[model samples]
Target: MAIEYIEGDLIASGEEVVVHGCNTRGGFDTGFAGVVKKRHPAALDAYMEYHRNGGLVLGSVIWAYDGRLIGNALTQPTYGRAGKHISYAAVEACMQSIDDAARNGVPGTPFSGGFTRVSMPLIGADRGGGDWNEIERIVETTLKSVKTVVYVLPGHRPSADALSSRPRR
Candidate 1:
């Protein structure tokens, strides 16, 4: 299990699966959701369809396959109610996503060959207002035994250093 931090665009990182912090309501209006929706409409549409069909819920992870990019968009409920304070649900969702990948070999198609790598922004930190220390601990502990290589992409705004250097709660 290896974790790498890259300061760049999450979408263009080219990881096997790109994890997205999404709301339980299935609205992709802001944050990573908005970016994914703009770049891959099919992914967003699939997420919405799944949500409408009672598939998306708190702590649930949904994989939307993108034909154009030939990759998978892994969306999980980081925020139960949109525009509200972050909750442990985000951490649960994140852990669940990783566990699912390790056990199920990535949701949706495996992209090129299989699910060996994944890229994602800081779960529940940006819009979800989650504590970085807690989020980091949860992620590290969860993936400690996994074999997949995970790349954590920092947000574009604020700068990677700025976000990481912020005082931890």
Candidate 2:
């Protein structure tokens, strides 16, 4: 019905499609996208290929699957010092695409498990530099047709031993 916020790893959330906001410039070198990139290099490769093909438009989506289905939303242009790189409109459009693909069917990317549940971190908030309230609103309206799981990381900071192994997005 509504979005469900749970504390855990978005990478291991196990939803049919894991949605996350990414830059349109095609660099997954840092932040949540970085973690996704590290976990699924194929996803970055897919995005790069898509980028070269001129599909990396703002407000567009790229479906990536390398053992896990990832809905890479082109919601921003670049990273680095920024006020708000995240485009709320782009986020909305991306979410709509994911909802449509899950509820209906995306031509080439056939989703398994009927695409019932989708998970994401607080996309565009921490790294993308977006307001959580607005991002939440956008997703709420766009993904009403499917189950949305918003994964919030626990409060405790990871120790040095666990730093190298933490999953961000």
Candidate 2, which segments miss by more than 4 Å at Cα?
108-114, 156-169
Q: Supply candidate 1's per-residue lDDT for 89.
A: 52
> Each prediction's Cα lDDT score?
0.58, 0.78
* CA shift of 41, model 2, Å: 1.7
| Per-model TM against the reference | 0.72, 0.85
**Model 1 CA deviation exceeding 4 Å by range:** 67-84, 111-114, 145-169
Candidate 2, 55-150: lDDT as tens digits: 789988888787778888898977665678898988988998888878776555557434888888888887788987788778878887788887
Report the C-alpha displacement of residue 122, candidate 1, in angstroms: 1.6
RMSD of 1: 4.5
Candidate 2's displacement at residue 161, Å, is 27
> Which of the numbered candidates is closest to the native, going by highest TM-score?
2
lDDT value, candidate 1, whole model = 0.58
Q: After best superposition, candidate 2 residue 37: deviation in angstroms? A: 1.1
